[model samples]
Target: MKGATMKTTMEKLGIIASYSRPRVSNDNPFSEALFRTCKYRPDWPTKGFATKDDAQAWVKSFTGWYNEEHLHSAIRFVTPAARHAGHDRATLANRASLYANARSQNPERWSGKTRNWQPAGAVWLNPETEISAPEIRDAA
Candidate 1:
């Protein structure tokens, strides 16, 4: 396998390789955001895990916190678990009502409209180009 390149191996296996454009940040935003969130966590070990078991334990704990407790900004500050369990609607509605009440009490405090608490419509990891949709629709 020393001289076997990825392209050659893929060709032999009948797998087509479709690569992203160089330096395109949108290509893997979800994964990139997750890594950033994990690395920037306050409890991330600076000294590194002493053993594989320690690392695994830490990862398990982190996963629990991330999915169950952390309020994701992109998803309107609701926990992933709540979103998965179909609870985000009520949570976001409660927040929106609270904000509206506060705004009504002190109109001067807010200069503009309250934060948009609308649920995120569609999330894409590697979204298609804007032109692709129209082209596909026209073709169809």
Candidate 2:
């Protein structure tokens, strides 16, 4: 009864529970992915961090690597930092050029056009299908 009441209250407030459906994997994909990355890291201690300071240090390091070094495939294999700083355009362009060169040098080895290698103009976690014209124009 208490759970049902709380759910009703939340609904009235326009709040949705993440695990509303049973046996459904509808959680935020980005957060789940980041957690998986952290859990699978080779440096992650099996037993957990020894102290608060240790946890903080590891988190700092992981955040640095995740933002600056990790090549996120969602963003065309560019690091978050590079994409945020508007440097991904040049990086993607360079990659595209390299792929073109490689394909030209070994024509027989390739069967299709080089990878798109185009920097995504905008990355959305959960985008709406009917995006506004203004948002599209701004992204361009």
Candidate 3:
């Protein structure tokens, strides 16, 4: 594997590879999480690979989807690109404003900024876990 060759070359050049103690798995938690996500994705090949090219292609596609369309519930139910591009903030704020009005109005009608807001009846029960009501106070 390329890993062995690289390690060997670095060792030959007196480049010491420093790593955390083996017992401390949390030292590379992010790396561990990425590998876990990649391996457990729904589209991953069930029977493993027949060729290096195939595996590489799958990895490329997976990385693109992961960085593009995948909704990370942990990050306000948006993809990384949307968050990085600033759309996520706007989206969250708009939704929160609508919901805040819905909440403040005591269920008479969807009378917030989204005038077209229908009850969607029980659909918002779970609601957005990430969004918070804006700091602005309700109108008197």
Candidate 4:
């Protein structure tokens, strides 16, 4: 089918073509987050990438830092690499203990409770909402 004919057929079938937002927002929250972090990195080039190899090398370095060095707030301030390696639990526990000890020695320094170091259970771009099943009607 040609462009116009296909569009008309899609319209009849209640199908709509997505035009805008090509690569800007791909609906992956995780990717969007990583992209935001990558853009904000201090080493992000002010000018565009010079060459394909330069871009690839930059991406590789950024990936290394993002996964191994950067502490992610969503995952209880643990690096993705640490979390993947099953080290986040111990890291968070150590943080909780440190915070507690600090607060005990300097109670006046803290106005509120210490930050929660508990592991973030699950990550979701859009959490699911409750849905009810459609009612069935008898047909004669």
Extract clashing residue pairs from model 1: none
TM-score of 3: 0.56
Please give the lDDT score for candidate 2: 0.81
Question: Judged by lDDT, which candidate is best?
Answer: 2
Q: Give TM-scores for every candidate, taking all chains together and pairing residue i with residue i.
A: 0.72, 0.75, 0.56, 0.69
Q: Give the number of the best model, judged by TM-score.
A: 2
Decreasing lDDT order of the candidates: 2, 1, 4, 3
The parts of candidate 1 lying over 4 Å away from their true place are 1-27, 129-140
Expressed as tens digits, the lDDT of each residue in 43-122 for candidate 3 is 88889988999999999999899979898766666678877776777777777686787678776664434432221222
Instruction: Give the poorly placed runs of model 2, Cα more than 4 Å off.
Output: 1-23, 129-140
Relative to the true structure, candidate 2 reaches a TM of 0.75
lDDT of 4 by residue, 23-98 (tens): 6574455667778888899999989799999999999999899899999888988999999888999999999999
Residue 55 lDDT in candidate 4: 98
List lDDT for all candidates, in order.
0.79, 0.81, 0.65, 0.78
Q: Which pairs, if any, clash in model 4?
A: none
Model 1 Cα lDDT, one tens digit per residue, 28-121? 5667778888888899988999999999998999999999999988799998899989899999999999999999999999999999997867
Evaluation by lDDT, superior candidate among 1 and 2 = 2
- Residue pairs clashing in model 2 are none
The alpha-carbon lDDT assigned to residue 115 of candidate 2 equals 87
